[model samples]
Structure formats: structure tokens, C-alpha cells
Target chain A: MRYVTPRKAAVGLGASHTGTEHHWWMTVSSAALALLTPSFLMVMGTALQLPERADILLYFTRPYPAIVVAIFMTLGMMHFIKGSRIMIDDYLEHTARKVAIIGFSIFGWAVIAFTLFALARIQLAFAQAI
Target chain B: MADVNRGNRPLSPHLQVYQLPLAAITSIVNRAAGQAMVAGLLLLAFWLLGAAAGGGLWDWADWLTRSWFGFLVLLGSCWALWYHFLAGIRHFFYDAGEGLEIETARMTSIAIIAGSVILTLLSLIIYWI
Candidate 1:
């Protein structure tokens, strides 16, 4: 009753060689993002409305807002990395596709790193001042 | 057993020849919106980094984001976010084996498009108020 052929079973993954991992992760991240998007939007909306630089910084200094942003940015970028790779795979081929995937993966990670670093700095500065 | 005629064979109707259905259009737009959100995220990262760095960097980023050009970009980003978000929900329903009927799918596709616009406008109005 096994649907898979002997070769497919031996190879484990399907023709693409990626199996279902990409789709699985994309589903998980998309579900998490479904919740995170609204909360993050509210946080960003409130932060942007503040007129003063210090006030904006102070707003993110609070643990709740900071945590929301940190999680959102990290998860969102990870989702983007996976999602964009699929899009690139569909439209590009060979060398160009390889380069685009690598470029986007690096960009996504850098954004995550920069976002966490900024959030940390905001928290540290607020701590030192008070 | 190479019988030839591979290159000469007529192919199925492709993107150019076929008019895509509503569901197909919505699905493709969802992908496009996801990419747009990436650009929006980069703008957000710049804003955050500038705030953390402070001084001239913050001033420059703040001014840039507050400018008319930036406003347009943010507005588009807002719409993209809503469109993608609603499309994600539709996808979830599809995954769960719901709303897969042709009529239902078309209705939901239209709802996504209209709902996203309404939500985007509502968010902006709330922000302005």
C-alpha cells in the first residue's frame, strides 16, 4: 500500500529533494505571523505617533512593546527568507537563482540581527538613564 | 527510444494565452504582497536602527519617513500587509478543507480584496484620529 516508489523511498525526499520541510516551516511561520502581525502593527502605530525621539525610544524600552517587536521582526524575517526562496525557485534558474537565494538569506538574517541589537540598545540606554 | 517531435509539439495555454481565474489572481497577488512587506520591513529596520544610534541618523530617518514619498511607501505597505494577512487566513481555511468550492473560493477571494482595503483605510483613519 506504500504510495512511494522504491527509489523515492530510498532517496527519502521527493523530486525537489527538499521533502516537506520547507512547506512545513512555511505553514508554521505563517500561522504564527497571523497573530503577530496585528500586535506588531499596533506597536508600530503607537510608536510612530509619538512626536519626540526620546519618547519613541522610551516607548520601546518597555518590556512588552520591546518583546513584541523582537519576536515579530525575528519571526517575520525568517518567514520572508523561506517564502522568498520559493518565489525565486519558481522564476529563476541555475546561477541566478542560487545567487538570489543566498543574497536574500543573508539579508533576512542581517535584518534580524540589526533589529535585536537595536532593541537591546534601547533597553540598555533606558536602564542606564534611570 | 527517442521519437523526436519534443520541441515541435504544441504546448498547453500558458500565462499569456489564458485569462487567470479570480482565485489564481488572488493567490499571485498574495505572493506579490509578501515581497512588498519585505521592503516595508527594511524601512522599519532603518527606523529602528536610526533611533538606537540617535543624533543625525535618527533625524535623517525620521525626516525621510515623514516626507511625502515615505508616506506613499508606508501607505502601500499598510495595504500590502492587510492583503497578505487576509490571504493567509484564506490559505488556512483551504488547508483545513473548507471553502474550496469554486463559488465559495471566488467569494472569499473577493472578500479578501475588499476587506483588506477596508482594514487598511480603517487603520489609517484610526491613526490620524
Candidate 2:
């Protein structure tokens, strides 16, 4: 269907609310930005800018840089999710859309959770060495 | 859609309020985002490149952090990063069925600005290295 029927729209009270500009912004940003994220990650995977690199693990075992990494990962992961959430909302209109959305939703949460896990468990060897 | 009627007179399409004009707002968002993306990618790519260059170059980066110029640049980046982060949070709240009122929107606008600065300073102080 091109658009929601009036009756369906009435039943979709929260759905209409879900379909907002902010949601669109996040969705559009997520899908569009996803194109950039993987490239950046591949770069990070090879590079050693993380705190624990360069035989300097001892220097970086402090609290400040750890906080920085924690902030960066947490914010980046959350942004990635809301962004992809927007993409799912806008383009997934089929019957399997629910499953797709759920799957992606879990993936996003998993990324955030994993990032948090690393943030808490960061050690010089693993965190810095990549 | 039926045209809005007012006092028995047919009203023209209410081109939504463009306080500064639609083109201007779009231009603002586009330009700000463009500047941010350019700077952000450059920083990310440069850091990766530096890391790939090995220890000597990496040591130099650590030294740069001590310089006035580098510190200023990092400070600016902190602002940008936190600004984007807070804005993303605002967007998240909108997704969660909050922050839709006129008052709340204004609060979020100010809050994002304040939050960015506050978070940046807090992160800096709380940093590991």
C-alpha cells in the first residue's frame, strides 16, 4: 500500500508517532552513515591508535584515556543503533519486516553491550593491540 | 487534502513557518554537517594513518597532545564529539516517545549544547591517560 489506510492509521496510534522527523533523521543517518562506519572500523582494526598500543600499555593504564574510549564507544554504538533503527523503520514495510527489525534491534543492542563489556574489561594487551 | 477554510474564505497553503527561511535552515544543516564530516573523517583517517606509520610517528602524536595547537584541536574535537553525542541522545529520546513538546524541544536544544560541553570536560578530567 502507498500509505496507511485511515482505519489502519487510527489503530496505529503509536506507529504514527514512531513515524516522526526525529525517527527519520536517525534512520536516514544510520543507513547512510553505515556506509562509512565499516570503512572506519577496518581502518581501526589495522591501526593501533587505541590506548594500549606502542609498548605504552603502562602509560595508558590510567583513568582518563579509558574514560575517553568508553565515551567514544558508547556514544558511537548508540548512534549507530538509532540510525539503523531509522533505516529499518522507513524501508522495511513487508511482512517479514518485524523479524528484520527485531534482528537488527538485537544486533544494535549487542554492539552496545559488547562495547560496554570491553570498556569495563579493557586491558593493555587487548585494548591497545587491537 | 482539503484547503483549510477561515471565516468563509479559502486559505492558501500555509507554507510552514520558516523563521529564517526554509532554504536557510537547510543550508545551515548541510553546511554544519558538511564541515563536521570533513573534519571528522580527516581526524579519523589521520589517526589511523599515524598508527599505521609505527611507533616513532605514534610517539609524535602523543607529543602533539602536549602542544598548545594540538590541545586546542583536541578541545575543539571534544566539543564536536560531545555535541554530536548529545544530539544523538535527543534523537533517541524522541524515538522513545518523549521530548515532543514545544517546551521539551527547547529544553533539549539547550540541554544538548550544555550537555556537550559538560560531557567533554568531564571526560577530559576522567580520562585514563
Q: What is the TM-score of each candidate against the true structure?
A: 0.89, 0.42
Best by lDDT: 1
Best by TM-score: 1
Cα-based lDDT for every prediction = 0.90, 0.51
For candidate 1, the lDDT comes to 0.90
Candidate 2 vs. true structure, TM-score: 0.42
Each candidate's interface RMSD: 0.8, 10.3
Q: In candidate 2, which residue ranges exceed 4 Å CA deviation?
A: A1-53, A57-130, B1-41, B55-66
* Chain B, candidate 1: TM-score: 0.86
For candidate 1, write residues A1-130 as lDDT tens digits. Answer: 9998888676857767778888889888888888887788889889889999899999999988999999989999999989999899999999999999999999999999989999999999999999
TM-score of chain B in each prediction: 0.86, 0.57
**Mind sharing the TM-score for model 1?**
0.89
Q: Write the per-residue lDDT of candidate 1 for residues B44-79, one digit (tens) a residue.
A: 888899999999999998888778877788889989
